[model samples]
Target chain A: MTARPKLVLENVSMTFQSDGKPFTALAPVDLEIPAGKFISLIGPSGCGKSTIFNIVAGLQPPSTGRVLIDGEDATGLIGRVGYMLQKDLLLPWRNVLDNVALGMEIRGVSMKEARARAMPLLERYGLGGFEYRYPGSLSGGMRQRAALLRTLLVDQDVVLLDEPFGALDAQTKSRMQEWLLQLFNDFGRTVVFVTHDVEEAVFLSDEIYVMASRPGRVIEKLPVDLPRPRDRAIVSTPRFVAMKKYCLDLLHMAEPADDLAA
Target chain B: MATKTTSLPPTRSLFTVLSLFGASDDKGRPIRKLPVRTLWSNWIIALVQLSILVTIVAGWELGATFGLIDKFFWSQPSAIFKTGVIFFTEGDAFTDIAFTFRSTLFGFFLGTTSGALLGMSFWWSRNYARIVQPYVICLESMPKLALAPLIIMVFGMGLASKVAIATALTLVVSTLTAWSGVQAVDRDQEKLFYSLGASRFQVFSKLIIPACIPWIISILRVNIGLALTGAIVGEFVSSQHGLGRTIIYAGQTYEIALVWVAVFVLSALSMVMYAAVAWLETVLRKGINQ
Candidate 1:
């Protein structure tokens, strides 16, 4: 537990100006993600879960405070983290192979080399025959898989996944969760995931950060004691069930306070 | 509209022929054999289209023969066809067509390329776009053909002036359309680019330009017609060559059949250009879009 944190959000906060008035979207907060941990941030809509992701991705800088990566102050700086959003956001025009090659190509790798590098990942994942298919023709689950593979190929140590499978159906979502667990381990990358489903958070995360809205802030941080290299079957375990129950209880408790003054 | 006028009656004749052969249609639910019906009717529709042309030409020919209409004014359809054949075979009609074609194509290429380039550059600076947008609207709202006299005066009533007029008509529309495409770009994709450490130039070249292709392709289709109109109008105003000038010459001499010949040639030229644009759109959009 004494391993130096991979990422730290020191007193991070956000306030937006709306209609000539001040609106605090996120209250001051400090969070540390230990190296190589699967962390989840679960909160209701507008709880600044996405705000934190935007700040961490450097798409938006926090109004105050800073972010640190490898103990280096990396506040308001982009390209340090691999970020995947809710929508797959695949270019409708590009086929799966080219889409997967985008991140490397942007970083000055020759397209031929980048494409050669991406080929094996496509084969290993479920997209073997779909390398030449356009995004519009792909099934939703397959598109998300392509998108996730694209992010993974970016090869950043820390990855931010915001509701990556939030749009999947129950059966597909379950299947994706199992697949993602495999990926998380095989890739050995630190991930900060944002999701609303408590069971999903409990299933995948090493630590879960529960957030409260109305001047959004972190309310609870629970460490999962479940053994490593988990599978979907573990969700039925009493320990997993209890952990999920505790997180759900925290979220519901935070909900009724939504009417409180900001 | 052609189908509505005379195409439907042929279906009755086909039904009569089929019924005579004991071939009955389900006409009951119309759910089955639906695609078969479309496939069957398409051929009939094509034949009917040919019949419609025959009917119009026969009517015009008969009218000219019997004096229901004046051959001097309407000109016999066969005479017009003969005149067209003669012009193409023995006269300089092909030269005229080539002149109009060159001016239209040149104007289209120059206007769309320059206009779309300027329009897309607006994405580089929000302040620049805000300042320039109103002027674009003003230019768009004003009738551009009115500038023909000035353009002709500047370029001198030659191929250059015709190209200038065509360019003037197409430029503003392409500017507005390309600018709108830039504005409507998906913010999520833009953010994704930024997240990938793409520089502003990379975002512009790789993302913005490719994403706006459909819009630009649409502009291509529209601008081709406008360019033709500009070139013809420029010729009408003043020109030594082109199909438009030939039409003016034929009209002044009251050579009605030659006027009809030039008009038909212009129509054929417009169709060829339109077909070309449609093909280009398909080819360009195939890679970037579904």
Candidate 2:
């Protein structure tokens, strides 16, 4: 039998109470992320993609529905899955090494052991000589890598990335995407990524979910047939272009008239 | 054109002076040459400061010599300096200094620790914080000096009274600022820790406390002055020996020079205390960040 999906969401929805009004941020939605697969949720602004992430991360409980990890109910339980946001969120008061080891430290690993474990990862990730440098002294790309290291150090199998590289410049972003892909390949972990960039989604995902806003729901689940160990050259391929175009069309149709006008 | 020509000579002289102070680039262009202003070296700044101080002292001495001002009331700088020397060399100034320093140190430590702890506790409990908010505001607004007699009455006329007043003065503001600091911790960071399965206490000790440290250090800097003021005020109300008591006794006997000497010593003491707090901030920050 096919391995039970690493993470499953059943009819999960979020309703935020704003100014005494019940506002539906996300409608009932179902998602299944298979083990050792990379899935991307691509949509326009206000698509409640981040809302879904917040739910899965257990930062907030879903107004309705359930979350399951390896078929076990984990509704509203925090610290069960790794979550990285758009911002690096590295503590400014911490150096690169300490920042990377923070999650493990919080998980009760002693500081000395955490640092020792982090050293090899730092060197492998090209952050070795700068391990003791403060986050402020690092470049944006380096900070994000450090943040990813922090997320990974805790040893969560399913990692949720919410536009983690959205703030990066184009060149740096491309390089980081390749680095992340290699890391993901090596780790063999389940990744659920959220991004508005179609090309990014097409480049990294094994499967892509096109979401619609205004009571957000997944409108389409498109399988990316791109080959393994994909790189920048893949973006130039006709199939890649077709996939990107397909996602763009769905996103365009998903946007509200007001958003189009602006 | 006429104004530019007239300004040229002075501007050139200023540049030359700045160049003399090593403000020139490799190619000999004056670095950041402001037309009318000359960059002063640390030595020059020190010299200018010393000159101003000397001028003030000379003016006071000359005024006293010429009878332009009443030396009995104002006390000439020379006589004040002589009294300060005597206090250091021949009098009980050392004992007074030691007593006041000890009281200030104790008060500073007690006030800082209590303020920081109370602030963190408030951060941990919203209900308790809300209940205590109004009372804290009221106490903070009430001039701490007004409670000096009561503090002295309760704690007695010794070092304990001085420390009590100092802690009282510092506690409110330090608690308020530190509480605000904890409140102002980045929402993302807090969420990050929570997502990592950090318990509420873990979130507090790992994230909230470390995040609020800069604020705590800043409050400590402010508390140093407040603590000193509290200690002196306590001594002023009732004390056997302290700089405050010395000043009071000198003033009562119209020993104006001795009073000036005490004032000088107090200012010096304040500077030393402020420097110590600043050094602590640097060391703590380095340790935490590293």
Candidate 3:
């Protein structure tokens, strides 16, 4: 916790034009995420939470400025970060085991080794018996678990999750949130997750960065002081409730004043 | 997963094959039982149909004895049966049937392979699609029968000309449908693979083409029929052998029975080809819906 930042974003800015005028999406923002910290970017729709992840993931080049990962420039840092999308994106034709081993497959890992490495992960996530079942047959929660396992199997230094459980049912989402927190604590992978859900960010993240619309800038950063190895009951705890309130206030500020003040 | 099925079940499954074929009756229910009005009250429709067919032949023979219709123009069923017997006995009719069957099968294979490959090529390259798609559609809309003479002129009155005509007729439709199938692949799935660091070639093979299998099978079924038509029409226009040639010869000699026999054999050939494609469609699509 006393070390330098693992990822540094210096004066990162992105501008998208609509109707022939330059509309700024992300303002020149500077931030630092310490290594092994679980960070969540929470914002209202169109606040560019996804843009931030995309920028960091190197899927999109920043309009200006640079992203540094592990002291290297972002351009040369691909495959160092594993990205999981909102959709499970599991290849439907492949079985559960293969889906979990996909990133390793892409990295030129041998089939035997990939399957062997994925075995413990699949078993740990309660998908051991379902190794041969296709993704189409798995429940949404199970698929997301497999997707997370896939990202983990890649052995990337940083993990970027973009609303990984946004498509799940409310009950399943709560269970998955707890599962993710437990998994993060056990593995201690540095996570930069993007979610619009204030509660989810509060419940799972070690630090929450709230973003605002119009200029997609970090308006507030709240340190989640909730205890580690969090459970379902943590959602109703006083600390979690206070953090959610802080996020709500930041989100209110992020919204255009005219839409909320009235 | 490899649980063996009893032969009895497979045999019973064929009884309901029409329902599996997606055919429904007027009441929107599957016609699992024989319909009353089809003139076949028997268990096996093909068998009952065959029996009724033979009774019609008997009636026609009796009618011919009583001079119901002119025998030369509308030949009796018995005479048709006799012509079949004669063809099998003294003539080279079996060879003609075999020739037609050979060419039809060859044409079907050529049409399917080239069509699939060309269609996949179009799918792989946008420029190819843009360049060849218009020409393909144009050629598809043209009557393939009209191309028979031109094909004969180009390749001579050989099996090559017949196969070429068949390929030209079937390939365009298959290519278009296959291209559509490839294009219709889910973008979400593609993005998933792309994010996983799959190259374009891997995505094309692992995601796009596998997703297009059912669509390709549908196109294959339709093209098989077209391929047969193209082959026979090509033969009718030029070749000295084949069932098509036999039909033309019979027509010239006013041998209506021989013409009917040739037509029946060709129809059966088309049905067998179609049935094989349909079976393949079942096998290919079985795991997809899951």
Candidate 4:
């Protein structure tokens, strides 16, 4: 028998009330993510990409449908999935170590135990000496790393990353992407990444779901056949370029369809 | 072939000479130097401030000695200082100081604790907040000192009355300020905590309370002055001991020097209270960061 998917969304949809009028943000959609797979949702602005992350993170209940974790119905359940938004969202008052330990503490871990668990990760994540420093004092890259560490320390099986590297400079973004790949591989957790960058979608995803706005819906599923242990050089390869071009074309097609819907 | 013409030295303007006293830059513009980092060390700035105070006191003494001002109406600085020495050494000044300090402390603690708790409760319950907001605004606008007689009648002419008045003066402002702070907590941070499976109480303790600390400290600073004002006002209405009562008695008996001494003591008390709050803020912030 085939193993059950790690996460499943059965006919999830969202509609918001805008100025007393019904505004559909997302059409009913279904998604299945296998255990330990890296999936990405690529779309334009207003495509409800973030809405999906919010739903998965259980920040908002979907207007329709159910969420399942390991085939167990878990709709509207929060704190079961780790989510890292585009902004680091680090608590300014907390030092780097304390911030990283926050999730564990919330999960009923003692402060001493949480700190002990967080201690090794700080050095591993290259935040060792700066652990005692406030978020305000850290650089953009360091702050994002600390945020990612916070998300990871939560010990969730499914991690939802909403354009996690979107705000970084090109060099930092590329570096973080590689670091995330290794981290995910080591952790073996299923990840659902959302991004507007087609190249980023192609580079990081095992499968990319192309979405269109104006009542957001998945239009295509493009699987990346790139070899394992992909590097920066893979991005310039012919196969990688071809896949990127195909996604760009799909996105361009999605725009006209969005306009028609508008 | 260049002509060997000699250039004359530039004439120094009057303003240029004045700038040597750290009033302006080399440009000779009429600049107002604040006694900050530009021209002096911090200690030097403090010394300059001290010099200004000494000058004022010297002027007052000279004016009284030369009969430019009546020593009877406007007391001499030296006489006031002598009166201050006597008040501390021989008079019941220590008892009055202790009484006023105790009243202010009691009011400050009661007002701040109740205000913070009420503010957090209001934040927790929007319906209650909506119902009470108008009343809070109205009470805040009312001059608390006007209720001195009522407070005295209720609590009696003792420490309780002074504390009650101080609490009245402090409560409304602290409540409103703290409520605004709670409201101003970053929405994203709240969502983060919620998404982490934090209960309402956990969110409050971990996020809201820590987030509202700076505002609470600011309110504490403000409440200190207000509490003192309440205590002094309560004493003025009816009290056997306190700097306020002493001032009133001195004024009635035409003891201008004694009045000046009491006023100086009150000023010192305010400064010490303010410094204590500032120290508390530093300690609290350090704890948060750690």
Give one clash count per candidate, in the order shown. Answer: 1, 0, 0, 0
Question: How are the candidates ranked when ordered by DockQ, highest leading?
Answer: 2, 1, 4, 3
By summed lDDT, which 10 consecutive residues of candidate 2 chain A come out lowest?
A253-262
lDDT of 3 by residue, A1-262 (tens): 3687888888888897789999888998787898888999988777877777777766667889888887778742345578888888887777888778878887888878999999887888778798889988889999999999998778776888999989999999988987887788778788999998988898888899989888778888788888776777887878778879878987886799776757
lDDT of 1 by residue, A1-262 (tens): 4989999999999999999999999999899999899999999888899999999999998999999999999887888999999999888878999999999989889999999999998998889999999988988899999999989998899999999999999999999988888888889999999999999999899999999888799999999889988887899999999999899889988985635445
Local accuracy of candidate 3 as per-residue lDDT tens digits, B1-290: 89997664344444456566667665445655565675655568878789998888788888887898778887887788888888879888778878777777787777777777777777677887899888888877888778788889998887888888888877777777777877887776665665666777877777777776777777878888887888888888989788888888889999998998888878887888789988878887776655
What class would a CAPRI assessor give candidate 1's docking?
medium
Task: Point to the candidate with the largest DockQ.
Answer: 2
lDDT per model vs. reference: 0.91, 0.90, 0.81, 0.89
TM-score computed on alpha carbons, candidate 4: 0.89
Consecutive 10-residue window with the lowest summed lDDT within model 1 chain A: A253-262
Each prediction's DockQ against the real complex: 0.63, 0.66, 0.24, 0.56
lDDT of 1 by residue, B1-290 (tens): 55665454436566666666565665521222434433557879899999999999999999999999898899998899899899999988878999999999999999999889888999999999999999989989999888888888999988999999899889998888888899889899999989988899999988999877778888999999999999999998899999999999999999999999999999999999999999998888775574
- Model 1, which residues run further than 4 Å from truth? A257-262, B1-40
Residue B239, candidate 3: alpha-carbon lDDT: 91
Q: Give per-residue lDDT, candidate 3, residue A101.
A: 81
Error of 4 at B132 (Å): 2.2
Chain B, per-candidate TM-score: 0.84, 0.84, 0.79, 0.82
